[model samples]
Target: MRLLEGVLIVVHIFWLLSFLFRFNAKVKISTNLVAFILMMIHFEAEGHRWQMGLTYVLFIFLTLLILKPFIQRNSKKVKLDSENKKKVKKFCGILFILIYSISSFALVIMMPVFQLPKPTGPFEVGMTSRHLIDESRSQNTISKQEAREIMIQIWYPAEVTDDNQKIQYEAFPYEEWSGTMEFIFSFPRFFFNYLKYNESNSIKDITVSDQESKYPILVFSHGFGSTRMQSYSQMEELASHGYFVVSVDHTNDAGYTKFPDGREVMNRADAYSYSFNIEDEKDVKTRSRDVSFVVDQLTKINKQDSQKLFTGKMDIDRIGVFGHSYGGSTAAQVLLDDPRFLSGINIDGPLHEPVASSRLKKPFMFILDDDYLFLTDEEIKYTNVTPEEFREYHNKITELADFHYEEGIKNDTYRLTFIAGDHYTFTDFPYLSPLLSLDINVDQFHQVMNQYILAFFNQYVKGEKTDPILLKEKKVDEFYYFETNIKN
Candidate 1:
């Protein structure tokens, strides 16, 4: 809840109480006046959310409370028996208060602008975004533009200066992508205007920390129909621990991506499609090329950044790659195709051909919602297919997944399976609303997630001692399953 919003709600409830308990007329009048002022200020400055709609309406009725005396003085009193009138008025008052109290509390709770937990590391986090176009690769998918375009958002360790407090976080992280992302918002974009009050832990575009001469670079790939901002919590956490993390938004596959020149790209496949499609082979290949292209661009940016943002601050040789869902497939392929990436992790993404059958020499890991075979009920609803079709789709995917899972574990690979999680569990979507993944164990999910994610990268990318981190384990009533391979 907002500051003035909570204050106004309390004052109004108190005003109502004062009237009910027959408190002093001065107390009633003063409370109403204070609440009125707060309502006006909150509406104008904090902006109104529909969650507090009734709160506002009841506040405006304060005038009616104050004018009751004048209204009676002006000769408009109901000529009724004293007992009957008192009972009627009391019933009406109680009913209205019940409706107001219940609805207001429920609505506000439904749309809280939750604060992201602070980064657990010593350094503060800073982030900046860049737009890159791969001229070498022609547009493989349907598009008006010729070259493949990519948007990279980088989060890095920042000097803990007064500016960290001075600078404010951007309320809507995906302001540029929101318009083209109508699928995420069933109503108009204004429905999310309340996000203006949302706060982020990482400050925007601050000076890089000089504590480390060159920070190890970690490349990120978001799931299909998701932008680079999806895993912001994980990125900020890694950045705070002195890692430079860059997340890529694959133009055609992202929910939406807007370039500085006003060009926008939307998802080529059905953004709402939850079921797996065989066509992912093309996507897996194309997005894998995207990883290599981004790596190439980073190499140049490290040598001579276009804007001097990362001039010599990148420990380019120590680069690692990781991705979610489809991007996870991309990450696996990139680790195989490009020797530049020392290690990689794929979060909740099924594997495809070639990589599914091929061997992995480098250290790798896979984090999944389950065995990665069957789709949940939500996915079935989103897919909306006949029984036969669903069976066929499930069969094909699981077959490939079985091979992919086996091949991944044959070498130095790790796996974490959240028995009760869904695809969004691997991302920060749960923080927006638990409704996104109803069955997810959010607290436990994050506990195991961050612990191992950091442990994996720290050990592999920076050569930090992670203590067989990839293969450490214990199970509690089958909540989650962890596996690691010790390849001495």
Candidate 2:
């Protein structure tokens, strides 16, 4: 248990004692002591000024109550003052009730709200993913390749009605996983307790009649060591607007993950225990194959499930892939290796894979970090990659790609450099805690990335009209830069 929870429990015990022993003459002194203790715990737990003010008021009242009898003891002892005793009992009873109720209420109310913000639109997303689907089938294969298990979350547009079909934000099975994440992120264990309240409609396996519509299917993979729902703000927003989005959580690589069955997978703590090396790239290739497995399953599921929303809505030809961090790198590799993917967008991942050196004919764009892109000619002169290696890496995409910087203006074309965006800024960490957002300015950074990503996918995948915001040179806040892929 966290220190906060322990303090809260102590406060509750003291308040209970106060309620039970309020009438005892000696108990009045102890009641005041407990009130002081409660006040101290409440002050530390809440840090809110109003809570402090209430604590001060309660302390004063308890102090007066403790003193009232002592100050009148001599005068009252000389006579059997029944009326005075009754009056004192009634006063103490009200005082104890008031202080105890306020303290209890504050404990319940002042605690933080912990939830990854749901998308601000109408969508019910349900996802179930399996990591390393091939491994389960490859029981006889003795290949020592590190295959990743994955958790997948699917988001879809739900029919809004009077009926409640809400999906849960965090499932019961994920409770222990949350505890593990608390340790990983250096947060208090109880920090995720409030996630219990994040209730939403579940994604029903009902069928849709949009067989003739041919909606574009979008596949999303989060960065390595991140949950599938890590980008909820962006994924939910996309689904709410009509696209079917599936987010895959790479097993062992995610902070926490649960397979479709009863199995759960967590991050490999030892994977990064020592010095980071090129073997990391091989692990990435393993993750890339997982993406292909998800796509393969979805393609088949879309064809077979005649009684589900995803039955025939997928326009396989209109499919696209996008991801952040290592996931971005995976998308790039998958697009290159798999012909099933038509278009791909990579956000802030370098092309360091050996296979990445091979040319990709696919129409893809890279939204790279500013620092990585603005490497000066002089810097390159000192580096191993000649202008030719850089050219081969950046100049091979078919539809052209944009290398965005944090300082560039938003452009109408698909490519633009964006500034102030950190690697983790494009995830759900911003909406979870203001402290986290301040630590990295995740809110402004992710909002900008999500907006542009949506616009980009909408234009190319759904054939929607390009928004003019894409062409404008603008800064949403102090922390973002934009850049685009260019044709060499």
Candidate 1 ranges with C-alpha deviation above 4 Å: 17-24, 40-47, 64-78, 81-89, 137-143, 161-181, 261-264, 371-373, 376-381, 391-410, 434-444
lDDT by residue (1-488, candidate 1, tens digit) is 66777777778777777776679989988888888788889878887777787777787777687878977897767676698878887787777777777677666766666676678888888888888888887775563548777888889998756644666665647453344346455446566556556667776777788888999989999887788888777898889898999998887777778788886665656655643555546777788788788878888988998777777888988989999988888898888788989888988776766676677778787787765646556656666576567777767766665555556445566767788877777777676665765776665677678778888888889999775656556454457878765664
List where candidate 2 sits over 4 angstroms from the true fold.
1-111, 114-132, 135-149, 161-183, 186-191, 199-212, 271-280, 306-309, 368-418, 439-444, 472-477, 485-488
- Which lDDT tens digits does candidate 2 get at residues 370-465? 443334567456545666765554443211233222112132234445555455566655444454445455545655666777777777677788
Name the best candidate (by lDDT): 1
TM-score of 2: 0.63
Candidate 1, TM-score vs. the true structure? 0.87
Each prediction's whole-model lDDT (CA)? 0.75, 0.57
